[model samples]
Target chain A: EAGVTQFPSHSVIEKGQTVTLRCDPISGHDNLYWYRRVMGKEIKFLLHFVKESKQDESGMPNNRFLAERTGGTYSTLKVQPAELEDSGVYFCASSQDGRVYGYTFGSGTRLTVV
Target chain B: LAKTTQPISMDSYEGQEVNITCSHNNIATNDYITWYQQFPSQGPRFIIQGYKTKVTNEVASLFIPADRKSSTLSLPRVSLSDTAVYYCLVGGLGTGGFKTIFGAGTRLFVKA
Candidate 1:
């Protein structure tokens, strides 16, 4: 089976612009997660979607960032008026079940805000 | 969530066994230990996870003591391709209760 896949391996945007990153999880996976890492920082969780419903979103940095999994299949993370701090690697991961199995991560989208 | 501490970096030979240890002194009763490997520009890939005792898979081995306060990830006869950043994360597997946090991770370098 194919692993989780992310779109636009690299993206460069100007500050104050908007950007959207996409992720397609493995087949039959119900747990999808979004994470990102800023420069010189560790990867941090953004949110999680269990099918079409969001299970957790406490890690979302601010109101400018939004994530949605409409069909519970693919997910999109949108950042409005992106700031310099928003530049980082955005990673999407999926797990068959919340427990007893490890998550599979995508290659990640490297966002650069200039 | 329990905080994990691991060596910042390690070096090993191409055909030598590499053991990376992570310490989680205040691990919760139901927390599981997980290890992930990340290449330069890729997201983390799960290597192994164990609650207690030893768990071995085709890729690597995860050893957790009885206390579950620490765990070791052992890669046998590592090759140059094994060089990557390894992260140890601890968390409960509940549906909506816990979140997985990634640390700086240990950077492994395999030399020929």
Candidate 2:
């Protein structure tokens, strides 16, 4: 099976700009998750989706960040008015069942806000 | 989520058995211990998961004691390619009502 795929492995944007990251989950995966890691910090969860409905989004840092899973297959995270602090690697993951099985993670999109 | 503590880094050599341990003193009964390996510039890959006793797979073996507060990941005859950061995660990978966190993983440097 194909692993979770993330696009634009790296992105550089100016401050106050908008950046959108994309992820394509493995086929038949219903549970998709978003995680991020800033420099010198641990990988942290951003949100989770079960099909097209969000299951948990408590990890999102602020209102400027928005995530959507339109078809229950792929997901996108948009960071508006990006700040310098928003620079980090955004990761996407998918699972057969999050509670029971392990999740597969994408290579991650390295975002930089200048 | 239970907080985990592991060695910040370790050094091993080729053909040597390596054991990395993680301590989670406040682990709950329903929580499971999982290990993931992340190569440089890549995402984390699940190594193994176990609740109690021992679980072995083609890649590595996970040993959990009766207490479940601590777990060990054992790799046999590791090669240089085995060098990577190993993260020990504690808690249920539940669909709801769960906080996902990653502790400072153990960086294993396998020498030739």
The iRMS of the candidates, in order, is 1.8, 2.0
Candidate 2 second chain TM: 0.96
Chain A TM-score of each model, in the order shown?
0.97, 0.97
A-chain TM-score in candidate 1? Answer: 0.97
Put down candidate 2 lDDT per residue, B1-112, tens digits, no spaces.
6999999999999999999999999998888888999998899999999999999999999999998889999999999999999999887755663666789899999999
Q: Write model 2 residue lDDT over A1-114, tens digit each, in one string.
A: 789999889999999999999999999988889999999999998998989998989999999999999988889999998999999999998887776346899999999999
lDDT score, residue B11, model 1? 97
What C-alpha lDDT do the candidate models reach, one value each? 0.91, 0.91
TM-score of each: 0.97, 0.97
For all the candidates, what are their Cα RMSDs to the real structure? 1.1, 1.1
List candidate 2 segments past 4 Å from native: B93-97
> What's the C-alpha lDDT at position B34 in model 1?
92
lDDT of 1: 0.91
What is the Cα-based lDDT of residue A54 in candidate 2?
Answer: 88
Deviation (Å) of B89 in candidate 2: 0.5
